[model samples]
Target: MRIAKEIRDDRTVLSIQEDRIDAHNSGELKNLVLKTLEGGAQNLVIDLARVQFIDSSGLGALLSGYKNANLRSSGFALAGLQPRVRSMFELTRLHRVFDIYPSLQLALSA
Candidate 1:
């Protein structure tokens, strides 16, 4: 669960450096997202370019972050999803629920 954090265009970009987001480290991802939002990040973008795989727990973690962000009237988005990882979101129909971009640059611009 190595996540890199940076600020771009007033948005907090959290880059997942791991290849997979599964049951083992989903909790860490969830906690980090919550903590980042709680720390006053109004715009949050998760960069998942490096993540090639994700399970239900991983999706749940991200959904939790999305819910919390909405509760606070903040922005939450996902960027650079690998094809395989994107398919999971599609299969679950989560792709429609999330603001997804092809690249971090596109997400930041939006």
Candidate 2:
């Protein structure tokens, strides 16, 4: 659950440093996302380029973030997903529910 946080173009970008997001660390990730939003980030982007794997817990964590952001009228997005991770989202039909981008740059611009 090591994450590199930065503010870029008025958006808080959280780059997950780990390759896997599973039950072990999904809680940390969820907590981080909630804290970032509570800290007053108007927009948040999760950079998942390095994450090659994710489980249901991971997806649930992200969905929680998304819901929280919506409640606060903030934006939540996912960027730079690896192929396997992307497929998991697709298979679960969560991809259509999230604002996903191909790259961090594109996400920031949007």
Candidate 3:
């Protein structure tokens, strides 16, 4: 599967199971996230621990999820970013837009 879904406390975590989140799967990723929110997820967390590569489309999907969560009055966060993936967020300045954590445990606690 490209994604794994789980609920931890009040947060619904969508962990990307792929090595790369790019053009091919971005659309599907976006849809799954929105569906998760519609299914009553109060807090959304995108776990990128296994994703090593991401592109503009992937970033867009994340942003869409963030906006959708905000519209629903739910919180959104990101966790378990690999170093290169973390750098991509940093370079794009998306790090400022999302609450990023080093691990899922930290994100869950927050």
Candidate 4:
């Protein structure tokens, strides 16, 4: 898994560069999120624009990361999900659990 990080405004944008996020690499993804949070960002915006696939393990990683962020009085959100990825969240009812933005720009503005 390839992950990129940037600070947009005051939010940390963690962009993922992979089509599949599963048991094969969910731990790496989670670690990247932790590193971003440790970088002094309170608002976490995970940019999933390039991700086209995800499985249970990936979803679990996201939820765990969000929970960790929330523990610090911060929170994690998502942006730029493809239709297939979006559908998965909706199917699992996680779409309601997370704040989904149309793009990273909008997420940053929020």
Pairwise lDDT winner, candidates 3 and 4: 3
Q: What is the C-alpha RMSD of each candidate to the true structure, in Å?
A: 0.5, 0.6, 0.9, 1.1
**lDDT at position 39, candidate 3:** 91
Identify the leading candidate in terms of TM-score. 1
Q: Give the alpha carbon lDDT tens digit for every residue of 21-90 in model 1.
A: 9999999999999999999999999999999999999999999999999999999999999999999999
Q: Return the candidate ranking by TM-score, descending.
A: 1, 2, 3, 4
Query: Candidate 4, residues 1-110: lDDT per residue as tens digits?
Result: 88888877667888998888989999999888877777677889999998889999999999988888988878689999999899999999999999899888788888
List the pairs of residues colliding in candidate 1.
none
Q: Using Cα atoms with residue i matched to residue i, what is each candidate's TM-score against the true structure?
A: 0.98, 0.98, 0.96, 0.93
Q: Candidates ranked by lDDT, best first?
A: 1, 2, 3, 4
- The lDDT per prediction is 0.97, 0.96, 0.91, 0.88
Candidate 2 Cα lDDT to native: 0.96
17: Cα error in model 1, Å: 0.4
Q: Which candidate is the best by lDDT?
A: 1
**The 10-residue segment with the lowest total lDDT in model 4:** 32-41
Q: What does the lDDT read for residue 60 in candidate 1? A: 100
